[model samples]
Target: MPPSPTPTGPRIKSPETLIAESGADLEGHGLKRTMGLFQLVCFGVGAIVGTGIFVGLSDTVAEAGPAVIVSFVLAAITCVFTAFSFAELGGAIPVSGSSYSFAYAALGERVAFLVGWCLLLEYGISVSAVAVGWSQYLNELLDSVFGVQLPTALSAGPADGGVINLPAVVVMAMAAALLVRGIRESARATAFMAVLKIGILLAFCAIAFSAFQEGNLTPFLKEGAGGITSGASLAFFSYIGFDAVTTAGEEVKNPRRNIPLAIMICIGLVTLLYCAVAVAAIGALGADAVGDKPAALSLVVDQVTDSTVGGGIVAFGAVVAIASVVLAVMYGQTRILMSMSRDGLIPRVFERVSPKTSTPVRGTLIVASVFAVPAAFSSLDVVVNLTTIGTLATMVVVNIAVVALRRSRPDLKRSFRVPLYPLSPVLGVGFCMYLIWGTGWTTWVQFAVFLVVGALVYAFYGRRNSRLGAAQAQAA
Candidate 1:
């Protein structure tokens, strides 16, 4: 048999070199570093506190029973591990593509392409899923004030027995228009939504506590470790937005210092909010009440207060809350595409920025177009599971990327470091894989099928155009 051709010679881009390349203004990529620490924190909070808190909390409570509080902590712990790696890399590279860029710098080109594709899938599905959630709340608000409702045939997707989700598609298009305006504008909008949602949450908490019963906390381990783990696995979705902050590596001021700080601060705040909401919810309404309803929080509030006003307030917040998530997530998606485009891993149109807006105009439009159909026709359940699988896949790649980068470039500047070194990343890998497994065999098959498709795309397109490959060829 002919000896297999020895694979050799493509030099990995060092963090310093990639940093320098990005420092060349994302290679003229238009994202501005105008966002300060406060805005960055707001972005993180905006992204982290959305759909999961508003929609997934009910399912989480059901999964773990009243013991769901433990699920919250476990999910946060896992994200913190991955967040440390994100901080280190975001600070070290300070680029647009989050894990894809990190993987390219650390693991090499082919792997980075895969990571980027998964991220594209992850962020895209997240935006669509959040938009669907938004539609539910929008309809609720309309019904609350005007006593009118959208038809189920037009309001839901295939998974939910609807012909198409009109509101979901419309919401995504609106977000796309907002994003195309400019990055600063997008940040301001997200920050405003962040404050609005947090205030609404605090308001919910104040009311929820009034009806809290100590007996609700009795069967804390109602589902046992398995249940808690399952709940945690699902709850892990809440933390996905934290990494969305890293996609702004080029947009944040003092990214190296601020990225890590913002990550910690946001994670801390989200964790506290989740715990308070979960504990109060289970205590006040019991685990049985928080169902698969899209407007679960609003319903929870209505039960706690006899007045329609409380529910109205929550429904109002849900409108802004899911929008905030969609905004941050869509922003992350565009930036990731822009980054990959800058790297020649995707089409050049995704790399083009509006000179007027200093944002990736073409890329933003593509993101809007890509998810519009799915948002209109697919079930929220299908999109949400796909998003989770993509999230887990991204986290697993990021964990390994951190470990690889640490070994390959010990001298690179990292303003933030993972505390336990190998343990943090190793555990990040293990826990992410475990959560992926717990997502069930069906999700695994779905993920595998997606990756297979991604590999084929990379082979046909990204393989030849890869910037790293070109550089390697020139050097050789």
Candidate 2:
């Protein structure tokens, strides 16, 4: 066999170097530590409990019938395993890039760039998908309260046979404005919205269960095991943002303690709420009635009570919930880019923190503008599936990073550790891979193409411009 080529520069960045550099950044141009434990947990909840619960239930029910509840549980189990991996890394590294930083410190610079690339797909596209859902619920609210709604051309994207999704664009702009204001302001707003949405969902559960019938749950597994797996794949989208808590590592108070605690608490609270809502929805009305409906939650209340009042409340809540998601997810995306930019993998513009607002103003506006086009034009199904697969891919890297970091750097300070050590992270990888397998072939092709583009970008720009690689060259 031929020998492998050996010309190379810096690869792995030590965890100590990462920690020291982050400290230096914080003392200079880095984000402020404005978030406490409660705000951190609320941010996770705000990001996780949006479009998937409010608008996605109909599709999930269509796939699994009353067994959709099982799908929720399956997906929650997957998240719990991965959340542990994230908790350990988030505490030990405690950087704004989250998994990307973890990968750089353990895997290498090339792996870190790809992780950040996948994250752009996960966070940016998720905001667009949620905004599209927001437009649907907005129409419901308008029709309920004012007896009028936007024309199809104005409310829906081109994929849905409309001129433009005006409401989607509007909501994205709103989130961008809030993010550019400051992280503290954004965290406060998310906390309030998080509390409001939780109350709204709980209210929905009470109303839905009042109309529950045991008969409605008969023949729960509508399509057998395949249905549960497929529905579980879709349900995975609901948990995409729990790790957004980690992206706030630089902007959080006592991050080593708070980040891990917030992740566990957020996942537990969201799981219980998701399962409860799924059961209440299915038990109230048979799967057939709930499937394939726009504004499904509001529609369910409208039918069960023969009153628009209940429907109106749910519709209004959906608006607030989805808007909060755009805000929180957008915040995570900017921070991820900030870390990547500082490493010289991407443009330097993203790392510029506005002293006036203590946030990445340029990055926030650019992200909002770039992603808004898709919110105004793309299909929701394609966007959702793409985002789900991208998120799962990034999480797989995170789990592997946990195990890799453990073997490579035992001396790093960790406020939290995966309870079962390798077992937890190994299971986390397995579950993420299973969900990735359940997605359709088209999404796989799309994701493959995305990775290819990322590799090309790194080959042409990232590898040559990387700060660590340049430093290594100077030392040599």
Candidate 3:
């Protein structure tokens, strides 16, 4: 075997250097660091509290019964572990890419590209999936509020007995438009949607809690440990967007302090909301009824409260919440691609900035195309499984990167550090692995296939085309 050509030196720069290099990128074509802690909190909250609560809640309830509360706690713990790692890295780097950039700096070109690809899977699919869900709620709201019923074929995706999902595609395009206009405009729109969604959730909780009966608490562990584990694995998707806040490292004022605070605060707040909402839902409808529909909260409200008004409000909230999720997830995806393209991992088109808007328009459009097909024809189950696997895999990489960076670059400055050092990162990896295991054989198979494809692409294209490699060769 030809002594496998001694692996070339790492093409990518270290995170510290990347941070210094990013100053130029942040100057003209990027967003201003004008967001205060409060606005940052709202961004985190807005992104984190979306489609998961609106669409995945019933799925969790069905899997774990009232034990969904336990699932939420378990998922939150897992998220905290990864979130701490992200805080440290984001603070130290404070760059555009989230995990993808961090992995590139800590790991290497191939690993970074893989991580970036998986994140593209995570965020792009998430946006499209959420958009599809939003379409359903939008149709429901239209029917309830305006007595206008969209044709079933037009309102649903092709796989769901529909020819096309017009509302979903339209919403995705609208979010893209907002994003291209400016970051501040997108943030303002997200803020409005976030407030409206939270208000509806609180209203549902208030009403549901008032009607809570002891009988609904029966068989709390209905699905046993296996079921709770499954639920936790699924519920983890709900917490996925908390990392989206960290992706705004360069856009937040005092990112070192504000980013970490936003991550921790958002996780805590979203966990509380999820637990409360799950409890209230289970208390009102019981596991059986909640399981009947994937979008359970809205269904439960229609059954328990005044059907007309209650259902309308829940549907309206779902519309706003899912829309916000699409916006945030798409934003995260485009930014990661932008960073990767800049580093020469992906095509240069992804790195091209729109002169008028300064956002990566080509990158955004590419991601939209990739996601649109899946959203237009696939089931939510497929999207959720793919997302979970990609996210868990990325978390494991992030956790390891944290420990590796600690060892390799001990002198590197960081605004935030995982409190227990190796322990926190170790637990983060362990938890992520456990959840990944919980995702079932099919999900594992799919993840494996995706990784294989990613590796092949990197070998054929990324290795040679990488800007990092070109830079290294020039320096040599």
Candidate 4:
């Protein structure tokens, strides 16, 4: 039986209850624990390695010039700090909700609802951003391989002077279909794609580095401090998926051990690849050529090798990379909603798992459909900035939640702990704030509006129907 709502103040779920219920959910007909450490890392890498690298780099490079390499490093530093906090909480709670579950256990229901809302902006919007990037690469691949390209009407959105971005919508639908099949199948596909994309990126670096010139990197900081900070803000988008690994807590084998380890490993591995690729791209083509090229990497490869074959290979890899991002990130989004729905914060439909597939099919489709519309109409930059702001907001809460959990649940056993404890989390919060500060004023306004809307939604619907409030009412 479900509890009926009653007015109640803020409430936090105990770590013990959160862990126990999560375990039960996994044991019963909920999500299956099929992912191991390898698949887990692959999932993270797949999520983090897309869009920002293969497509958004043009803007990032344009923002920071050759010094975009420095922007990547700065963004990685911020992610590393926050990733530590996530590693600690994820290992302890091991829930499908990721940061939202962490907040519920440490920050109470209202804050948790908002964090979940921020995640909607993060993962949901990111699906559109990644899909938009995938469409560009798809066009690149076709033009290289078959000497034909998707017409602007079909490939670009209204923001890009096209009626609709059909390729973006098509790719989003494809990823959603794969997700509805099952988690095991999705993880396997992501892992294969993860490996293929990494190989392709490395090959791109090898070819590009051959033509690397010292002169190309001479005026690295042409855009100055403002550019680096703004570029870092954009670059932070690249690391969005690392935390998605933690969202798989319920689906991963031995959550305590694998979750933390996978997160740390994913961040370290991706930071290296991003920096190397940025350097190779800038060095080969110079910052001027790199700027605003939708398929910058493929263009770099083409110029370096003076052949479309080299460009074709990199384009193919990007298509695989961005597609995997849509799959993995959408999976994370559905799980977050499922956690919320189970708490009676949203409709129960989101929490229901299919008897046949053991996956939240309805929730997955709902998320994909809602997000695909944005992919069809909005530009890539618009969705990417929205995703970055939303992501940074959730991470700030996650960092604070880690500190609160440490103080409140001193006895809770954690497989991992953020090194330096308070300092690490504080730095995590600071770094996240710094990136958020670098964002354009317009994005901040949008984020403010988003928060206002989220507050209203929670107040009108989430607050009145919250499962925690019902539990408290019963206890009283």
Question: How much lDDT does candidate 4 score?
Answer: 0.90
User: What's each prediction's TM-score?
Assistant: 0.95, 0.97, 0.95, 0.97
lDDT of each: 0.83, 0.89, 0.82, 0.90
Off by over 4 Å in 1: 1-7, 24-29
* Rank order (by lDDT, best first): 4, 2, 1, 3
* Model 4, residue 345: C-alpha shift (Å): 0.7
lDDT tens digits, residues 163-275, model 2?
89999999999999999999889999999999999999999999999999999998977789999988999998888899999999888999999999999999999999988
The residue-by-residue lDDT of candidate 3 on 295-353, one tens digit each, is 67777788787676788889888888888888888888888877877776777777666
Task: Give the C-alpha miss distance for residue 318 in model 3, angstroms.
Answer: 1.0
Q: Which lDDT tens digits does candidate 1 get at residues 54-164?
A: 888877887889888888898888888898888888888888888888988878777888888898667888788788888888888887777788999999987888899
- Greater TM-score among 3 and 4 belongs to 4
| 3 against 4, candidate with superior lDDT | 4
Off by over 4 Å in 2: 1-10, 24-27
